[model samples]
Target: MKLKTTLFLLFSILGFSQQNNPASTDSIKKTNIFKLGEVIVTNHQNQETTNRVTSKTMESQNKMEVSRALNLLPGINLTASGSRNESMVTIRGFDLRQVPVYMDGIPVYVPYDGYVDLARFTTFDLAAITVSKGFSSIIYGPNSLGGAINLVSRKPTKKFEFDGSLGLIDTDGQRSNLNIGTNLGKFYVQGGLSYLDRKYYQMSKDFVPMKNEDGKERDNLYRTDQKVSIKIGWTPNKNSEYALGYINQKGEKGNPVYAGSDTQNSLLARPRYWQWPNWDKESIYFISNTHLNDKNNFKTRLYYDKFKNLLISYDDANYTSITKPYAFQSFYDDYTYGANLEYESRFIPKNTLKFAVQFKEDVHRENNAGEPVRRFDDQTITIGLEDIYKVTAKFTVIPGVSYNSRENKQAQDYNSTTKAISDYPNAGKSEALNAQIGLFYQFTELQKLGASVSQKTRFATIKDRYSYRMGTAIPNPDLKPETALNYELNYNVQFFGKLNFQTAIFYSSLTNVILSISNVEPGKSQMQNFGEAEYKGIEAQLSYTPIQKLIITANYTYLERKNITNPAVHFTDVPNTKVIGTVEYAPLEALKLIANTEFNSSRYSTSYGISVPDYTLLNGFVSTKVLKYVSIDAGINNISDRNYSLVEGYPEEGRNFFVTVRFFNSN
Candidate 1:
């Protein structure tokens, strides 16, 4: 299969390249940062880049989740999950929770369920994003079965620097970010603050009302978020450094519910009743690194994180009625503390050996209305080792192994007025062994081929074990860990010296898949390991420098997910196809124009086959440096005014505009 895919991709890209004029390789840098597509691989870590969104593009565009920064990459899709402010990032047909998120190589996903709300991660100080998918290194911890995303923050390189920006958008939304930093030779300090205010926004004119609800969407649907970040660093020598960093964010956003009856082909069944009153997060981390010598290196990291959220609702279907006042005001809190250490041995000429050890503990507690708190603790330990062996000048092989031990501790608050608690010790303990093998062969200076096979496993979350799914699905505490065996083949080529073409074909067989299924009768659900499943996909990216001043890039993904046991007629929560294209033109050195479009096919939210309407968004932005230290940006999103929603009944903003002004100085 890999050989067929390689040959097909080679012939296809080579034939396509013959249609374009020859240009310089330097002009083929990625469009988002360096230019559109250049392939660069790291020999030390065995990491490679297929695409990246440069800081320059991020600086000019409207900032949101880190997911938004990589939307153009193939097989990467963003879906509206629980609420408008909550988004789920799906990679290669995998659920959002199956993928792990990282910041500067530190895990940030809530330890209880390994879920991270991308909306809360505003792009305030981000420098770059790296996506490492299947066949990833063994050191990235557990629960990264599908993929991992790393958000890298920027560090000031100059002696003194200051940057600030303010943006205004439609629907009374406004935002501002301020940053200041300095590199004082021995000790350095940096910090940034961000504020965003969002009020009710409008939908497309073509939208059709459902469940007799007004076509005008909802009222008081607004959001406000703020962030603060600080970092301090000390450099005692050229090859060693120690740093500490802190981040805090708080916000509240209304959640829209599905109206009327989605089970009966009704797009809008339920009405919007509950809204997230407050969502807050805080993080502090310390990083230390030193090079013992040229052949060996050592690094360590420590981090602590806290997350809090509030959900509440009251009143009835109409404004004049009050049926369930003070119905519920729930508070959820989670705390995590973790430490990791890594050692790299390069004693051999062409072999790089890496060993990693990590420990993490998560304490999660929640209060119902005004009741006592129910707490759960999750503990984990992982040890991993890998070696990248360079067999020849053009051939490389990587083999790795990891062992993970996870234990869950549970305690529940009494239902009565008494404030006593009952504790259950060691509710679940799961241990797994995973391994992987990968090979990269440089067929030629302009062409490369890579293939890998991996075995991965993920443990169940606390909620997935004990809590009922909002009175619908019953949770079973004895659920087993989900596991998968993945295979992938990759081909990359540079054509005409100005075009970068890359393609990958991947397949996975997943077992012990946790899902909600029929309990015994109708209208009831139970969480269970339903059956085995298969997933396969093809992703391709083509970047061309048609001219020195004009660049074009396009990416597409085709995915198929099948339930081997059930043989269902529809695929739930997964889009079959995703596509993105971009055009960046610089008519003048100081003036530039950019445009991109994203497309997603229909997606089903349930086994019953109700789906969210497909959508195509057209966006464009123009930026100009009008002054030596000042720049201006303006853009329009969803320019086509297409009435659509990523999640059923939760309409997205339509035809919105934003403008920003930035002031920065590095000297």
Candidate 2:
């Protein structure tokens, strides 16, 4: 449908339904978010640095992937690894390696590189996603240098419940998902399945033909993903619960050839063809909560996660020949197992104390075509303690500390020339002490102020310390852990029950930052921990309900990053400024209309000063109930067909439309 026609019809319906009562927002809040996995402080009190994205918001925005959904929030930026055709995100200037991802409180990042492709994670089976910025709970274990992200699954509150959706995209893409659950008085079971497939995407009309791109449909832009999740829980009593969960994901994608002009100077910047034949992950976990008494409680989590992938590099864009020097096949097999035990007690008056112990082991194996497999193993352990002290009726103070240690047990080096595998030298160990303190004051029933300071650390990943960077880098086995000291202040208030405002300012000082030092050897760079940096940002969010039928929300972020050790270097991926706003109108009890816009400032894409220009995008959607149990949503994204890129050469999709039908039933 044309944009003008769609807008006119929507407004006409709104005018005709003026006499009808406005629909209740509660209708979209049917999903039951799991509470056990939340890492919150001060029991039931909301923190200023924490934000949550609900299933309702995800559905309304048509955010099918985790990375896109997170982009809706302030202080989070969606980034694309164009060369690899992978979607990623950075939180407050911190990459995934510094801020780990978790599913139901269990670590899920890849063991080799400490990164996960957010595009492969679908939102169909999730109830909510929580993000903690700058100041996260120490009980979450180690590696929360910038913050943490947690994916919360759904729980069944009804005897029988089901939710499903099917969608079609203009770019020859299809998506479908199904979720079912049953909740008996003492037992419950939940299961979900989702699939997504896409052939290609069209570029903007304004895009000019490039070396490897023809200005039409993007080449090698195919993807397929399938996921399955299941959970079983038993609540023997009101004070105790245990659950077992499992998830499996399979994905495949083709990488688009580089289309930029900087390929001539750098050997690693050459245009190439690559395809991932298989990208698979599996996880199994068990969680339990038990109340020993009115003043004491215990919680435990045990999990095992596995990852496997195969990459094929072709000689040319045709993807048929592989006889060239760069043509090769690479494979990775990695796995991690972890366990956590937590104990909480309120035995002391006005004080809640918690203690935790965590242990994890990661093993990674990788090999190339006709090469011997090399292996690496690492083990980490953490011990933590925290206390929430109520200084007064309206004031609270939280203090936490943790000791983390990581030991490398084995690292095998492959000598291709001699065809011999030998142990790597200086297989070392590292340890760090993390600490944090937070203070919150309730000015009134509708106003709150908070301040926090934290010191966190992240150990170098196996790839960071061992990989040769395609024969252009040197392995540094003695690399030290990176550390950051973060500070934040925030305020939240509500006015007349119609407007909500939240604002926060954060600053982080980083030391021992891992950077690539050029000319460490004849023509190779080395990863060394000799750099320092600083990151500062401010975020604000506003939500207002002007009338019973209309709601408006907006958020803004301003960030700055500086390389203290070397001002000549630049930070990549994250923008300096971002603004997003949305407007929603409920014309009738069964119909709603939404319009949103996003603005991103220019950002550096390479350390040598390559940048992507800033751009703005508009999107619109309409949702209506067709039946008591079914609803339909139609939307158009990139309404202006603006040509934009998060990276230098990766032009984003142009104008496109999608239609989805969703069904929900509960009893």
Candidate 3:
């Protein structure tokens, strides 16, 4: 399959590359600091870019996972479950529980819902993404105390067009996608659909089914997921525009990859087993994303996301005795509405000032047949002002201040049967005032230096305020918000040569940290306001393209995290060191072949002791343009099929292959 893809791509390139085309805006800004598609980006430039591995869009694929892709950045760690989406992201040694995420400058974070399922998001229509490490994210509120990820969706192009991709996987896996766009007078419409499916994989030579608690053997289950979206935009004139979009997704949940089975201490180890659920989600969004007179920015959006999950499991005692099965049926509804306004202008000849205001509300409700009904409501408002004073042609100073207020409410209702869990306002009405100051200096034509200091806050999430479960999961309503004092230094130097390198270092002190700690008994845990935690790290990135068709890149990160309370317990799940390297060869304009590898060091599972071993994996892919409007590609993951475990008891997929095909209609 890979060979076929390679041949197809070669032919496509031969036919397509021969015809020269106009260069894109991204290509022109390849080396510019504010270029549109440059991977190394400084959204607002917290520091120097030449030394920072700041941004990336196609690290592995055109679509990259926030956790997996961001981990390549210096001081960033992604704690995930076999790349299946339920993972958490941590930066600069801070816990995933503290980091926040944004979309197009809007705070898309849920006040109390710490889980930002990255699996549900796609980068199909994104212009660029910015990842602010350490104190760099102070400009954004709330979760920015730990750092932040900003996903910027692309706007409609001036001309109508279409683009898409297709592929297949080895051993009964296949995928395909299609996208189309058109502009009729003042109205624009776009629609897209994608389908993906993978069969169960065998991890080892003795790949026998695992026995369940009841001693019944269980088979590995893969997935078949589908996504569809349609969007429409209307522009009365240059002054206003509105967009409406709907996204729907449905798929099988993934079972935790497992390591081994303990026949004697089966009970303790069994709790670590994983099972995929039967679930689905659908959402609708409306946005008035328009610029006022091209100088002022304004946006208003509303969205609702609905999900249904069917969880199946058996009791521990069901091993020796036969018992009826239990199923947890749950439905989740999320509604969000928000607006933002911003203005940028130069009040003084060489001085620039920017002011912005934002408001957002989120409501989530979860209902289960036998469990208590859960409701979460949260709202936030923020006002900010910043001034950039150009001290001289070679230097600038930026000073900014922001005031934000947040309110969250959680309620659990009961009607007999099971007792209602505690309902507490863990995060009351809280408000914070943060301030930041940054200085940028151009040392020479080839060197730039930047430094910044800031104060930031992270509010308690809904899960911390009102979460309850048995064995290893307990909610603490008394958990307090997290705060941080951060410092950063960036250095970027460019020499008159073919080689380019970037480096950045950051440090932060976090107080009132929020974390999940295991209790005395197994399968029991609680979330609380732990004491201070310190995280510091540095990142280095190097890239060189000998020619337009060949590119090589390498990245490395080193991070350290410690709990101020004990100082001995190393933060869990975060790896101390990570490295990635990639090589791409584009022999023909339409043909691209890439080889990539990732390395992760040993990591802890719990603060007390249990840890996972370090491992490295190699993967490769070849993509080809089969025709003017179609393309094909194939790749292999876990090439060696190493039997390794990321999370306890959960084993990862062994060697696997996938193929995809794409179709586009521009006319």
Off by over 4 Å in 2: 1-31, 43-50, 263-269
Query: Order the candidates by TM-score, highest first — what do you get?
Result: 2, 1, 3
| Model 3 worst lDDT window (10 residues) | 32-41
Evaluate residue 648 in candidate 3 and report its C-alpha lDDT on the 0 to 100 scale: 48
**Cα-based RMSD of candidate 2:** 5.3
Candidate 1 lDDT over residue span 259-363, tens digit each: 324656432443446677788989898877778999887877789999898877645443332356435677889898998888888899998898899898889
TM-score of 1: 0.89
lDDT of each structure?
A: 0.73, 0.88, 0.60
Specify the highest-TM-score model's number.
2
Best by lDDT: 2
- How big is the positional error of residue 44 in model 1, measured in Å on the Cα after superposition? 9.5
Q: Give the poorly placed runs of model 1, Cα more than 4 Å off.
A: 1-51, 82-85, 217-220, 259-272, 317-326, 413-420, 520-523
**Whole-model lDDT, candidate 1?**
0.73
Worst 10-residue lDDT window, candidate 2: 16-25
